[model samples]
Target: MDAANLDRLVDTDRVHRSVYTDPAIFELEMERIWGRAWIFVGHESQVAEAGQYFATTIGRQPVMMTRDEAGGLHVLFNRCAHKGARLVGEGAGRADKAIRCCYHGWRFGLDGRLLSIPMADGYDGTRFGKGCPEADVQPLSRAESYRGFVFASLAAEGPGLVAWLGGAASSIDNMVDRAPGGDLEVTGGVLRFEHDSNWKFFVENLNDLMHPMVVHQSSSLTARDVAKAELGPEATMPPALQIIAPFTESYRFFDEMGLHAFEWGHGYSGGKTSIHAKYSDVPEYNAAMEAAYGPERVAEIFAVNRHNTVFYPSATIKGPIQTMRIVKPLAVDRTVIESWTFRLKGAPDELLRRSILYCNLINSSANLVGPDDQEAYRRQQQGLRAEGAEWVAMHRDLGREEDLGEGHLYAKGSSDLAFRNQFRAWKRYMAGVA
Candidate 1:
C-alpha cells in the first residue's frame, strides 16, 4: 500500500477496520515493522549450552538462534545454502560440532559460517565458492541481549536494544531484580495457544482493563464462588484464586491506578492492590531480595506492582507473576501465543510454584481466562468482516491525556490511552518513520 492508504488506516483517536482485517496491510506490517524492529527470539537460558539452537521467526523468515562453541550467541536464517532446505527442525536441539543439511549434507558452524560440503571434488575448478557469502546460512543484520532476553533486527540500522526500550527497560529490570541472584530464567515449559483473530487484538488486550470486568465476568465469578465454597470466608484465598478473581474488580479501582505509555508502543497499567501481596508471605524470598539489594531497594522493587507490560507487537510480560505471552502472527486472521513462566534464581521454590500455578490458571490454552478472551477476539474478527462498521472507536478519555514528557502519556480516567498509543506507533512503523 502507498503512504496515503497507510495514513488513512490509522489516526490519533480511531483506526479503520481494515487495519486488522486486510491481508495487504498485514504483509506491509511484516515488511516495514517486523522486518526492522528488534523482535524477541528467545531467552539466553534456553541456549546456555554450547551448540544449542532454538528455531524461531523474525517476521515471515524462519530463523534460528544458536550458541557457538565458545558460548557466543548468533541468530541466522534457517536455510541450507546448497538446496534451500531447512537446516534444522522447529524447536531446540544440539548442532553437535556443525549443522548438516538433511537434504544435501551442506555443513555450517554454529555461527552460520560455511564449514564444509559433501562431495567436495564435484565442484573442482568451478566458481562455487568464489565471492559467494550467500552460500552460507545468512546471519541477521543485528542481534543483542539485555539481561538474558535476546532480540534480533533484520535491518542493519536502528536504535540499539536499550535505546529502543527507553522507559520500558524498567519492566525487564523489575523482573530480574526480584530474584536474589539478580537473574531470571525461562523454566518449566511453554504453553502454545492459537487464536483465530488478528495478532494486534491480543496485544491491545494486554492492558485493556475495561474488558476484564465484562468479557471475563463468568470465569472470574465462577472462580470466586469456588474459592468461597472450598475455603471458609475468613480464610486467605489461594494464590491461584487470587489471580483469577481479580478480573471482577470494579472500574474505579483500575481508574485510580495509572497507565504508563512509553515510546515504541510499550506500555503498562497497574492497580493499587498488589497481586503478589495477596499471597502468603515467603520470608525466605523476602530475605533473599533484601540481602541482594538492601532493604530500601527491595521495598521499592516490590512496590511496583505492574499487571502487564506490552513490549510492542510481540510479547506481553506480567512482571508481578514472572510470566510472559509471546505473539507470533501467522496470517491476518491467525496468531499463536507462547506462554512462558520464569524461575527466579536464588528465590524460594514457593515463588516459582506460584508462577507456574498462575500460568496454568490464566495463561494456558485450557485455562478459563484465556479462552474467554480468545472467544471475544474471534467474535470481533467475525464482526469486523461485515460491511457495517468502518472504524473502531478509541475515544475514551481521548483529548484529556496529559503529556508527561519523555514519551509518556497519562490519563486520569479509565481510558483507551494504550490503544491510541499503540496505533500511533503502528502508523509510524507502517509509514517507514519509526
Candidate 2:
C-alpha cells in the first residue's frame, strides 16, 4: 500500500479494522515492523557454557543465539551456508566444537564461521571457500544485550538497544537488581501459548487496564473466595491469593497506579504499585538483598514495580515477577506466545518458586487469567470481520495524559493511551519511518 493509503488506516485515536484483519497489512507488518525492530532472542543463561545454542525466530525468519568458545554471544541465521537448510532445530543444545548440519554434514563454528565442508574436493576452483564470508553461517546485522537479556535487529543502522529502551531501561535494571546477588537465569522451562488472533492483540493487552476487572472477574473473585474459605479471615495470604486476586481490583486502584508510554510503541503500567506490589514477603530473600546491596539500595530497587513493560512487537516483561512472555507471529491470524520464568541467582528459592507459580497461575495458556484475555482477543478477531464498523475506539482518557518528558507520557491506568501510542508507531513504521 502507498503512504497515503496506510496513513488513512490509522488515526489519532482509532485505527481501521483492516489493520488487524488484512493479509496485506500483516505481510507489510512482518516486513516493516517485525523485520526492523530489536526482537528478543533468548536469555544468556540458556546458553551459559561455550558451544551452547538456543534457537528462536525473529518475526517469520528462523534464527539462533549461541555462546561462542571465546565467551561471546552471537546471533546467526539458522540456515545452513551450503544447502540453505536449517542448521539447528528449535531448542537448546551444545555444539561446542562444531555445529553439524544433518542434511549434508556441513559444519560451522560456534561463532557461525564455516568450519569445514565434507567432500572438500567438490569445489576445487569454485567460489566456495572454507573461510569465505558468503560460505559461512551468517550473523544478523545487529545484536546486543542488556543485563544478560539478548535482542537482535535485522536492520543494522537504527538506534542501539539501550537507546531504544529509553525510560523503560529502568524496568530491566530493577528486575536485575531484585536478585540478591544482582543476576538472573532462565529456569523452570517455557510455556508456549497459541493465540488465533493478530499478534498486536497480545502486546496491546499488556497495559490494557480496563479489561481485568470485567474480563477476569470470574477467576479473581473465585481466588478471593477460595482464599477466605480455606484460610480464615485472620490467616496469612497464600501464594495463589498474591498471584490471582488482584484482577478484580477497582478502576480507581489502577488509575492511581498510573500508566507510562514511550516512543516506538514501548510502554508500561503501574510504576508505583501493581498486582505484584504486595506479595507476601519472604524474610530470607529480603535479608539477602540487604546483605548484597544494603537496605537503602534494596528499598530503592523495590520501589519501582512496573506491572508490565512492552518492548514493542516482540516481548513484554514483568520485572517484579521475573517472567517474560515472547510474542511470535506465525501467520496473519495466528500467533504463539512463550512464557519463560527467571531465577534470581543467590536469592532464596522462594523467589524462583514464586516466579514459576506466577507463570502457571496467571501467564500460561491454561492459566485462570490468560484464556479470558485470549477469548476476548479471539472474539475481536472474529467480530472485526463485519463491514458494519470500520474503526475500533481507543478514546479512553485521551486528552488527559501528562507528558513526563524524555519521550514518556503518563496517564491513569485505565487510559487507552497505550493503544493510541502503539498505533502511532505502527503508522510510522508502515510508512517506512524509523
Candidate 3:
C-alpha cells in the first residue's frame, strides 16, 4: 500500500476498520512496524548459563537467543545454515555443546559460527564448508538488552533501544529497581494463550482505561460479591479479592489515575496509582526494598506506581506486578500471547508468589478475567467484518491531552487520548515516516 492509502486509514481521532482487519495492512505492519520496532525477546536470566537458548519470534520470523561459553549473548535466526531448517523448537532449552541440525549433520556453535558439516570430505570441491561465514547460523540485524530484558530489532539502523524506549523506559527501570538487589529473573515458566483477532487489539486495550469496568463486569462483580459475602468488613483482604475485584473500581478512580503517551506508540497508565496500588503490600518485600535503597529512596520509587506499559506492536508489561505478555502474530486474524512472570532478586518469595497469582488470575487462558477480554476481541474481529461501520471512533477528550513539558503527554485515564496517540505513532510507522 502507498503512503496516501495508509494515511487515509488513520486520523487524529479515529482509524479505518481496515487497519485492524486487512491482511495487506497486517503484512505492512509486520514489515514497517514490527520489523523495525525494538521487540522484546526474552530476559537474559533465562539464558544466564552458557549454551542455554531461548526461542522466540520477531513478527513470525523465527529467532533464538543464545549465551555462549564466554557469556556473549547473540540473537540469531533459528534456521540452520544448510537447507534452512529451524535449529531449536519453541521455548527455552540448552543447545548442549553445539546446535546439531537433525535434517543434516550441520553443527553450529552457540555463538552462531558453523562448527562442522558432517561428511565434509564428500563436498571438498563445493562451496559448502566450515570456512565460509555463510555456512554459519546468521544473527539478527541488532539485539540489545536493558537491565537484562533482551530486545532485538530486525532493522540495524534506528534509535538505540534506550532512545527508542522514550519515557516508557521508566516502567522497566522501576520494575528492576523493585528488586532489592536490582535484579530480576523469569521464573515459574510462561502462560501461553491465543487471541483469534488482530494483535493491535491487545496492545490498544492495554491502556484503553475505559473498558475494564464494563468488559470485566461479570468477573469483577462476581469477585467483589464473593469477597463481601465471605469476609468480614474488618477482615484483611485476601490475595484473590485484591486482584480480581479491582476491575470494579469507580470511573472516577481510574480517571484520577491518569494516562501517559509517549513517542513510537509507547506509553503507560497510572503514574501515581493503579489497580495495583491498592494491593496489600508484602511486608517482607517492603523491608527488603527499604534495606536496599533506604526509606526515602524506596518511597520515591514506589511513588511512581505505573500500569500496563506498552512497548508497542509486540509487548506490554505491568511493572508493579512484574509480568509481561508477548504478542506473536500468526496471521491476519490470529495472535498468540505469552505471559511471563518475574522474581525480584533479594525480595521474599511471597512477592514472586503474588506476582504469579496475578499472572494466572488475569492473563491465563482458562481464567475468568482474560477470557472476558478475549471474548470481546473475538466479537470485535467478527463484527468488523461488516461494511456498516467504516471507522472506529477515538474522539473522547480528543484535544484535551496535556503537554506536560516532560517527554510525553498526559490525560484523564478514561479519555480515548491513548488510542489517538497510538494511531498517530501507527501512522508514522505504517506510512514510513520518521
Q: Cα lDDT of all candidates, in order?
A: 0.86, 0.91, 0.89
State the lDDT of candidate 1 residue by residue for 271-376, as single tens digits: 3453344566789889888889999998898888888888898878988789999989999999999999999999989988989988998899999889999999
TM-score of candidate 1 versus the correct structure, residues matched by position: 0.96
- The residue pairs found clashing in candidate 1 are none
Ranking by lDDT: 2, 3, 1
TM values, all candidates: 0.96, 0.98, 0.98
In candidate 1, where is summed lDDT lowest over 10 consecutive residues? 271-280
Best by TM-score: 2
Q: How many residue pairs collide in each prediction?
A: 0, 0, 0
RMSD of each: 1.6, 1.0, 1.2
Give me the candidate number with maximum lDDT.
Answer: 2
Ranking by TM-score: 2, 3, 1
lDDT of 3: 0.89
